[model samples]
Target: MTEFKELYVRKGSVAQDYIDIAQDIYVEINNYFKIIDCNLKFCRMMNKPRTELFGTSILDAIHEKDKIKFQNIIRNALLKKFKDGIIRSDLVDYKSRIIATTMKLNPILDDNNNIVGMFVKFSSFRLRVEDSAVNTIFMSIYNSLTDLYTIYGTDTKIRINHVNTSLLNILGYTRDEMMGRHVADFLVKNKDQEENIKKLFKSLESTGNFTGEVLYQAKNGEEIPIHLSISSLVHNGKVIGSLGIGRDMREQKRLESENKSFELKLQNQSKLAEFGMMLQGVAHNMSTPLTGIKSSAQLQHSRLIKFKDKLAEKYGEDREISDNITDIMKFFELIDQSVSKLSKIIKNMMSKSRDQQSLSKEALNLAYVMNQEIEFLYANQFFKNRVEKNISIQPDLPVIYGLYSDFSQSFVNIIKNGVDAMWDSPVKKMDIVMYYESGAIFVKIKDTGKGIPHDIADKIFDPFFTTKPKFKDAKGEEPNGTGLGLDSVRSLLKPYRAKITFESGPGKGTEFIIAIPVKENQTDLNN
Candidate 1:
């Protein structure tokens, strides 16, 4: 019979309907952190069979250093402030690899208000490591970049001064005793090596660097082998001093019976360059997949909207819930909105780092660009619940004839700096207002983040200067970043002939305003 066959078809289609609706939701698990449940997407992300994950504790897979943070997050879930709070952290897998993750924790309470469990809704983001990773990778990054350890000297007279605790412990010398002495005073001389040592010092003076094996007399009167490196410290175009890094070569000698001082420098530089390339690749990989995801969601939403229109036209009547057809149409519309929002976010993030193709000046809608930029800000994981925002643009704003990408880049950079400034603040909010006045377009951005200290206010715009801490991993080990972002902002605005200035009070907030002059003859309204 038709009725019996229809029932069978409905039952067969039930699982498909569930999958479609759950696509936007996250994978779930029980309170014990056992993998009692998961969606197909989460299973794919983990690349694990559901059966193998059934009895395993999620915490069991996390790195040891990060477990305490995870536990604190669990405890915070009990507090009302944090019950619905979003926690950003890294997740570890069976292979001991760290994966950056952002998730919201919703505590489930029972009839008596007893805490039962929690539901975690995971959000998608491209991860940026804040700490250094494991030993091998950390060592390569540590050596070639910045000097974390070893002895130091002044080139004026080679005075052994300003030694750090690390080198002090290694050399068995007190800082007070070494400060005034010439570096050569500590050298353990050989019968025939005095002339050779002088030649080596002279060679470095001319070349501005040295990397080689050397021997020095410890405070204990024992000769110690060292892998030494020294580079000129230039100031105002003069070599004011020399910075040196010396590693104890004993362990390396025991393994390879040779020094790798020069090789280490090369290796570090190579690793740093390779890592830079890897970051670019990661950006491409993340963006390409997200673009595809957005397209697919958009396609589905489009189809659903067409079907809803068909229903409206065929029925020719409006009734509340009307067999739930209207409800179904509304659901699809919501999905379309969400997917579109996510797509804008992804597009903004991807465009930020890519080399902006040169654009000739053209008329651009100022109001539209700001709204797009604000929506992109919401997509940022750091500002999800961390920062509040109020943005207002004057109605029917006059259009500006300029490089569109330039304004976009400049605005995004300011917004990003505002976000970074508030990282330590309790209340993080951004207020933005744009208006036309006095034949100029004015845009102001203000943040309730830690304001610029007077000392560094002068240097914030300097090339290669940044207050941003080095990007490290969960273990808190390595350093990363190029502090040229704001400098580029200044350069980006050159063609537009814009004037940018800011006001700051420590702990109060910082506000940056940009003003672009408009010609009186230029059109003020598109209409």
Candidate 2:
């Protein structure tokens, strides 16, 4: 025996001792084992007679499907000289029962230190197989719940876990095509979208959920609007990833835009109808007085001329009578001047009324138009004594395309309101300035009189609203005005697409600014 010192006998005792200790462990572990040269307990664990299994290779007893895997484990153990090795795999036996197994391989060495075979221990695969089936069912249910679900790590990189046909159709991409792509890469055309997605993830890190509108591009180069809802998944109180769901909103947005446009058109038509009614009223009121004034002035002038000639001839030689005749002549001169002023007022009113009725548009120098109105205001005796009106038409102002008479009348109405606000106030000064800005024309009228009361400021433009006391006038108690001064002004301006705004403070002053969009045909006076 080459002085082996009875190593087999000692080893056998050691092995038997290990088998005794492992007997209790194997019972607790629910695992089976095989021994090549020793132990009745190991053979009992496999439910086989000791002679049938003791000398057989472990692979011969393993299920066919698992034999190769076990062999590989044994080979690795032999090559690496591993004391112990583990092999995990699934198998189905000749009886058609599924088995999920974990095999532990331990190398057995002879007394001379040469490798022998191996000790193989394994557990029945039934429990593991059932667990795997449950996992698959859970995954199937998860995928069904989410049409286009993806998990994003804290780093913002997308990890696609589930997607349905609806999501694939909407995105116009195949599942395999989108699997590993970055979420932002699909939104490269819209930088804002990428930035927003980044911000959304950052917010999710803190709050655990985020919901908002996001724009995405499809494979067809079309922009798709989506409502993205994200929720963070937490495990053990730490945010591991986020889940995202997207709903398409492009059709909804289109419908909303259409509704808005229709509403705007309806509003404009209503405003136009109201304007027509106001225009009719203004024309009717002005035409009557203008016709009467023209008739009266002509009749008075003819009678006065006849009277003046008769007096001069009768007092040809009488000095006192001649002086009286001269005084009479001066009186007629005063009447003539008054008639001329009344004519100008009627002309301006007629022009404004005609333009309002027609809504005719034209491009005119704003400065020239404003100056004309200011001159008329200055010439009127009623305004001259009570107010000092000054006009500064900016030389650099561009021409504005609008209804000439309508634009002028709007300015006149604003200025007239300024005068009316100071009817009984001590202060009396008005300044009109016209300028150009950013493709628009602006006319500003400021008055150094008591401004409108804060309580009634908003009501100033209401129909039939007035601060003036009703009174019977010389024209057979003129019917009370419909209080449509500002109302008409606002209505007339609608057709021209102009805006009128005012700022006022008690005892400080009131300033009205009228802005009209400049058309391309508008002449640039500055250029």
Candidate 3:
């Protein structure tokens, strides 16, 4: 009947499907254990075609040690003694290579319910049960975690075997596109960074790991900066591969750059505030000479008017007229001296506050720079009245090539720092010596005050680091230390290829020495 035939067809299909389960290699064999039909995997395992595998005794492929066990399992299945008979066994391929495998057997029955053949499934042994479980857990974490960029199984030749989703997503590449590529292919495209890349690999091989910043290029043509840590993956006392873990450093690098920019702005603002305080003192100091000039002029005018009348009354007396003439000349001399002092003060302020854009590389006379800075320092009442300055200048000091403003600011900051260091000391003295030695300009600024503590001496040049109290100027306007003075000095000196060093001890004194190299072709302008 049609219903009976359809049922038989469905049953036959189900029986065929049973052999495909839980195995890569499956076959149908007669009760005599000769292969009648086999899947592609079975042919591949035997290293032969299906035509050659057909009618071949299955025992021929079974390893000698496993052959008896495999035959026993098949016989048990044929007898219907065990339904899911399975055995751990080994097989020998056509090339005589042994492969560990797990085998499963099931009986095939005929229409009369007699055992006709058997179905056998062989699964290749790749991982032990414990290793398989661990690998599964590792894969779950590797793919699930999204923040960390990971690369695994990078072999000794630097070929990339596996990359996590995080790295693939960041690099804009699929797993297939990145697999089997050299690790350096994704890194160090920039020619300037090639040397550093070589060093990184060298360190990795020598030390078993490397931790540093590296550049990675993405598929979208974007360059990514990464802080990568790569450690060797050792197996059986040999390094077989490497594991790389990385973090995206672009955001952090951006923040650091922005922070430096912000610090520079703060430094400029601090300088402006200090300049404003200096201007106030200079104005106050100028007022005295201005008052003297005004008062002397008025007195001279009144005295000359009265003398003019007396001149007519005593016209015949030459002695009185000559004496009056002499007194008028004395007043003129006093006014001239006041005008000259104001002029010098104005010139010093102008030189100190020159426009930054105008500060370009040129031959700078050290003596002139020191004189201008020293004169400007006097504008601060504390430096003028409180601290005693001992200045030594060598005649014809060699000229160094740099921006005038840079040199001026560096000089002033050092002197100002020395002055501030002596704020609490009873013997407040600052010694500044500038001389030429070894084809370089040497400037030594020393202060006899509270010296830098040994613990903090090394950190003095760091931005926003300070221990000084707020400085109250002539107008009583207190501006707190911006902590960028010495830091600014350090930055300014870098362009000139200069070096700054200091010697200090608690309660003894602090001395800072700056050495600026001179260009060989240039000579001292003063010479």
Candidate 4:
């Protein structure tokens, strides 16, 4: 009989032991509670000295404020014969810190099935003191005190949660008047800003965060500019809402505008100074040729009259004297040639000067322009012998839209540099190639002479920078140039949107590439 009872009872104990172990491990165990009755596992979990806790009320450990709720739970459990119930409240732990508790209750029954009492189990749900203090510091620092702060819920409704003293002062409104209002109510002055705010919230739903400047309206119909930085508030790896901090930028915007105006005035003054210098150089350059032409004409006039008088005396007949007069005209003819040459130079100078101020938009044949500049450069005696020139233009290259004089000057400057580079070279050959790519015309001038030094390549295009020997006057004394040729070239090409680049190394050749945008509907030579 004893062995049969042991085997039957052992099967019932397995299920009871499983429940007892789960209650101790899976539930909170540091909370305040009183045990009315417990299983063997609960007895071990609480370290109780008694064998059973039946017939004991579990309300003995209840705090004064929660004793009424605890007693009500017990009475309800007895009336309903509840197998399990719960009471949620706060209690002080052994360390005297307030801890939140959720108590689990299990009612006991007598042999007649009448309610006897209840067993109580509880867990502590409060955060650690250090963790709570750190959270409070973070909240105080991140929260703005000088602006109206808002957080957007996941449903996209803006909730006004914080209003600082400065924001209330600016808008002439009390904190109560501003808090709890929608963000749109303050955005009345800027419809675009309101729409953008809506778009920002919608985007945040997909992309987590956004920040930008916005304009808000005050209660008195005034605009307030703000620099807003917004980020998503996340919890448990999920974005719950968005937080925004606003900084006023009205004074900042005014300062930026003032600075911009000052800079524009300074740039205009600089350009005017450059223009005055260019005019002075041009006047000085033109005076030499004009003086020479004047002297030559005066000398030729005297020689012509003397020759006419001598011829009239030798040839007695009137018709013969007329013929001799025509012969004397040849001397004047030479003077005309000098004057014509001077006129052409003056005309070219005038064209260059006018082109500096007014850029003309016309379709120009780049190859023809290159050839003209080369012909002009070759006409000079020094360049004629010093540089060997080869020009190859692709037949299918199209015309570019640019000012004629400006484009010609750009090519002339490069050709002049090429000639100057070859003065010391034994084999002075320059290869120029023109081609078209995409919508741009490219002219590459490559020279077979000592190239620019690698260190000064970038400085070559700078104003007044030169590698050429100092200019010498007619008596071999060094003369100074205006040192504005490359500067003028750079300034002229700015309006045309032209690009220039070069590749050079010592002993290896120098290559310069000029690319200009081609015009639509322009014809190519090959076509």
Q: Best candidate, lDDT-wise?
A: 3
lDDT of 2 by residue, 397-513 (tens): 765666666666677788877887666578788888888888777888899768878998898886557766454542442223335567767876775567888899899889988
Give the TM-score (vs. native) of candidate 3.
Answer: 0.50
Report the lDDT tens digits of candidate 4 across residue range 489-526: 67667766678888888888888887776654353323
Candidate 2 Cα misplacement greater than 4 A, ranges? 1-337, 356-361, 372-388, 394-400, 403-430, 435-527
Sorting all predicted structures by lDDT, with the top scorer first, yields 3, 1, 2, 4
User: Residue-wise lDDT of candidate 3 within 1-527, one digit each (tens)?
Assistant: 23322333354476345543424677779999999877766777777888988888989988999888778877876777874534688888878988888876656667887878876667777745445777889887987776544555545535787788888989989999888887788885877569767877798778978888888899998888888888888888987788888888888886785488567867775787577567757866877877678677767767776776687677865777767776786776677676777766765565556533343567768788888778767878989998888999886987666667777778888887787778768999889999988878899999997899999988888767777555553234333475778888897788667889999998998899998887742643334
3 against 4, candidate with superior lDDT? 3
- Higher-scoring candidate on TM-score, 2 or 3: 3
Pick the TM-score winner: 3
Q: Each model's TM-score?
A: 0.38, 0.35, 0.50, 0.41
Per candidate, the number of residue pairs that clash is 7, 1, 0, 2
1 versus 3: better lDDT goes to: 3
Q: Where does candidate 3 clash, by residue pair?
A: none
lDDT of each: 0.65, 0.64, 0.75, 0.62
After superposition on all C-alphas, the RMSD of every candidate to the true structure, in Å, is: 43.8, 16.5, 17.8, 18.1
